[model samples]
Each structure stands twice: as structure tokens, then as C-alpha cells.
Target: MIDPAILEPLADDAWPARERKRLGGWRLNASSGYSMRINACWPLAAPDRDVEAAIDAVEAWYAARGLPPRFKLTDGVLAPADLAGQLAARGYREGKDTLVMVGATDGEGDPLVRLSFSADETFETVFTASAGDPEDGRERIEALGRMPPPACFARLDVDGAPAAIGVAALGGGFAGVFGMRTVPAHRRKGLARRVLLTLLSEARRQGVERAWLQVEADNAPAIALYAAEGFQPAYCYRYWSR
Candidate 1:
């Protein structure tokens, strides 16, 4: 069983923020508010100061940067135990709930899937077209560009057009899948499954032992797809924001 404690940091490194700071064990990440994970503070453990003071400092930090303060709290792993209560008392509302799923890396890769060290034009096209918010797509594309070496950007083309895209961020013997998208016209064709298999196959080749991906809790179709591929839920996290 992969520990959520260990996987959380790997996830952070996989999807890095533009600017990062530390309030003791808490991680303060800011990235233009495109994604909650990149814009929120992750309290993996207790802070150096009291919880209330630490919350004040976090708000101040984000305020200095002209962004709202947010927190990513994982169930069963909340540091200081009462952190959630404190956030609620402070008027922080619970936001998007996400599930972290884990699976083995061993798999047969698809030769038709195009792999690149960076997000190519096709990948960006598919991602941006599929995203509900253009700004979110742009920010994610930028994040993809920031992925360190040994990362893989997987794309599958159908009828000479980009249909599906996914990303694998490799580090610390783990591979994290992000930016999984299928063009609306291409949905239900199992393109996502093929993309996932390709990613896991490459991860295995690169010596990654485990694979992880995050999906919104309300996305039943995606959850079913991942579950069919042997991915099991390891933990759930939600953002706390005003």
C-alpha cells in the first residue's frame, strides 16, 4: 500500500507551482490561481507557530501576492487534527473534492501514442480545446513545460488529428499522470484508456514502481475508467478557501 503521506509530496513535485514557500511543514504554493492544487497551502504537518497564527501568516502570504489563500487537506492525514475545524471557524468553505488513485506501472505500451519530452503543438491543441476554461488550459500547459527531464507527454492521434492527451511526471520512483484529456468528439472511444496504458508502460520502462493520478470525486466516468485499469483509491483531498 502506498502511503498518502509519501505520495502527497510526490504529487506536489510532479505538478509544481510557480512560486513556493514553506511555513514549517506546510507548503505554500502560488501559480496565478489557475488550479487549486498549485494555488493552495498544503499542511502536511503541524506548523512552527500556533495553528491560528500560522493561518494568519498564510493569508498574509497570499495577500502579498494578490491571490486568495487556500488549503489542501487530505482526509485521515490532516496534521494537528483540528486544522479543519480551525479553517471552518475562520470562514473557509470546503471546495472541490479530489481522489488520488494509485496503480502499478507495468503495462503494454501503445506504439501509436506519440511521446515527447515537452508538450507539443498537438498536445496543447487537444488540451486547450477540451478544457472548460481557457485560462486553466493555458496554466496547465505552462506547468507541463516546467516538468523536469525524464517526463513523458503522451498524445494519440486519430484520423490525422489529436484525439487524446496525457502526461507522466516521473520522480522518486513514482509516476504521476496529469492533464488527461480527450477531445469532446473523441470521447467514449477508449482513447483515454490507451493513453493511460501508454503512460504506465513508459513509466515502467523508466523504472517507476507506482503510478498515481488525481480526479475530481464527482467524475464518475473517469473514476470508473481508472478503476477498470486496476487503479485503487489511496486517499481523498479537498480545498478549503474563503
Candidate 2:
């Protein structure tokens, strides 16, 4: 079995959205439909019977909400041995394997970057401005805002222009990095790296030694950048949906 010390903190870091319901040992998170991480049931533990019951309850629950049934499976938890088999029997297919990476929090940000925890209108404005599509952007902003305490928003400005944006959540002895984005003209300028270091530095200052983040397995640029920063992939997780 994977150690609870590692499992619980990773879950808290990645799936920090509000809980719509707790069925069996799974967490049904549906605060937003834009991202499966927030919309699926996390099957980390439970008996086979409870898992089956949860499978039924979750399908109905999401059906009532006019959404599809989904599950997030990770390698580290007390999941049933046949969890994947059961989902496959229900015709649920896997999607988007993501790597969970961890590393030491070192190096302060570039002189141009700034970290802010106020989460005011200006932060939302700048973040959504560069993010694609207003509707999805609003969903992301709301989801990020709804995350539990010990969080902040980071921005990088060049010549008084907002160049990049990132969000960091501190919990469970780790600084969780998310929403790292650099504007079109700012890509290749290392704004993403600056934002990451800025957040990691702040996290370290706050007495955290470790930092973590998630990246799509196929995102080579992001994976390369993080690898260069000394982050090693700890595990993988994927979503399954019918």
C-alpha cells in the first residue's frame, strides 16, 4: 500500500475543489465542468461492494446533474484491485495521463515578477485576459478562488505589461503550482519559469521545503522546463469516463 502521508497530501494539493458529495471512499467533485479533475469521483479507497454501490450512485448523481460519470484513479491509494477492470466493464475509457512532480523550492523569482495573495479584481482580470475564452476563464478563476486557504496568485510584468500568470496553493508541507501561463508574445522569454521560481521561493520562505505540480504527459515543453528545475515525476493519474 502507498503511504497515507504521501497519498493524502497529493490529493489535497491536486483536487482542492469543493466536494459535491462523498460516496463510499470516493470524492465527487463537480464545482466546474471545464476540468475533469473538478468534475470526477476520485476512487482512492473503499471495499469492492462500496465501490460498486458508488459506481451506481455516482452514475445516477451525475446523470441527474446532466453530466457524465467519471473517476480519477491514482497508483498510490487503497483502491480495489479490480478498480480499472470494473470501470472498463462499464465502458469507461481513460484519458489524459498526467504526471505529478516534486522538487525542492529554490531560487527567488526574477526582479520583474511579483506574487500577490490578495486575489482582487486586478488579479482575476490579468489572469483571464491572457487565458483563452472568457467563459472557460471564468470557470478556472472561480475554481481557483474556491480552493482552500494558503493560496496566492503570481504575475510577471515586462515594461509595465502583464507577461505571465500563475497560481500557487500551500498545504500539507508542499507548495502546489497550477495555472502557469505566459502570453503569446511572452512565450520563450522564460516567464513561466520565473513565475514558478517566484512561487516556489515564496513557498520556501513560508517554511515549505518541497513543491509540486501537474503536467500533461504529452506537454514536452512544460515537462522539460520542470525537469530542468530538478522536479522528478512521482506518479501518474488519469481520468476514466463513459
Candidate 3:
């Protein structure tokens, strides 16, 4: 289990967009009118002590900014047994439950996966084809406007066509894999797997010892695929929104 203290530092390093503030011994993070990824909110006092004041302050902070207060408690947190119910009473509900899967580079098998990465027309085609909504996709790309080059874009083309696309960032000795998508026409043809494997291979090549990614809890097929590739769930988290 990872220590809760690790969260404050990690959150600052990995998720810099959110503002970090320590109130009444609990750390509450918010991004103006945007979003907040609660890093840690453990009671500085005893478990039996009242945390109402702290909770109220956090709510007020969000209310003042007209931003929704959100929290994500991973399975590794020690205070969930004590804090979850209290949070629920305050109107915080579990949102998307996600699996935090990790893969180690040292473990076995063919390090070379038959996948090609190229920057061409196929790249843009894959990105456009896999997007369920053009506006949303464009918005996401814009949100990542600060990400550095090289790690920002990559696409896997299969048989002269765009099959899958992936975006990643390197942080804390881990590659934060995000925006992995496969075109609808390429689904179930092992395209997604091949692309992901290629991504992992690239991460290893970049000296990343571990790779971490999140998948919605209900995404069974994706979970199965990761599990088969030796990725294990290190923890789980659910987003909470009003």
C-alpha cells in the first residue's frame, strides 16, 4: 500500500493543473471553475474526531469559486474505512471507478512487438476516426496544450490505414498513458492490443520501469486485455461529482 503522504507530492508533480491547498490538516485541491482531484484528506486528529469543519471548508471553497468539489479515493488509501461514509453524507458520490494497472519492464516475453509508429496522414485519420465526437476530441487535445512534444502524439497504422492512437506523458518514473483509442472499424482485430503493447515497448525503451493507466471499472474487455498482458490493478479510484 502506498502511503498517503506520497499523494501530496505526487499530485503536485503529476497533476499540476489543480491548485493544492492544505486546510485543517487535510489537503484539498481545486482548479477554479474547472475540476479538483482530491489528493489526500485524512484527519489530522483521531478518527473519532469530527471532520465536519474541514469538510465544510472544502465545500465552501468550491462554492465560492462556483466549481464542483470532487474527490478520488484510491484503494490504497488508509482512511477510506473512516472517511468514505462521511464524504457520502456531504453529497459526494462515487463517480467512474477506474483500475490503475501497472506493468513492469523486466518481466519476460518478446520485447519487440510488431507495431509501427509513424507521423503521416494515417495519424490524423486514426485520431479522427476513433473520436466519438469531434468537438470533445478537439477539446481534449486543447486541454493537453501544455504537454511537451515527442510524448504528446503517436499513432499506429495497420495495413496502410490508421488503426489506433495513443497519447502519453512521462511522470514520476511512470508513463501516464492516456487517450488510447481504436477506430470502430478496427475494433476486435487485435489492433488495440497491438497499439498498447507498442506503447509499453516504447515506454520501456525510454527507461520507464513501470507504466500506469486507468480504465473504467465497467470496461471488462479492456480490463481483460490488460490483465492478459501482465498488467495488474495496483489500486482503484472513483470520481465524485454533484
Q: Give candidate 1's error at residue 140 in angstroms.
A: 1.3
- Top candidate (TM-score): 1
Could you give candidate 1's per-residue lDDT for residues 125-233 as a string of tens digits? 8888776799988877777777777899999999998889999999978899999988889899999999999999999988887899999999999999999989999
Cα lDDT listed for each candidate:
0.89, 0.77, 0.58
Greater-TM-score candidate between 2 and 3 = 2
Q: List the residue pairs that clash in candidate 3.
A: none
- Report the Cα lDDT for candidate 3: 0.58
Residue-level lDDT for 241 in candidate 2: 86
- Model 3 poorest ten-residue lDDT run: 38-47
- Residue-wise lDDT of candidate 2 within 78-107, one digit each (tens)? 577688899999899988898888888998
By the lDDT metric, which is better: model 2 or model 3? Answer: 2
Instruction: Please provide, for model 3 over 99-155, each residue's C-alpha lDDT reduced to its tens digit, 9 standing for 90 to 100.
Output: 777776433322333333333455555555455577544434443443433353456
| TM-score of candidate 3 versus the correct structure, residues matched by position | 0.71
TM-scores for candidates 1 onward, in order: 0.96, 0.91, 0.71
The RMSD (Cα, Å) of candidate 2 is: 2.3
Residue pairs with colliding backbones in model 1 are none
Displacement of residue 51 (Cα, Å) in model 3 is 3.6
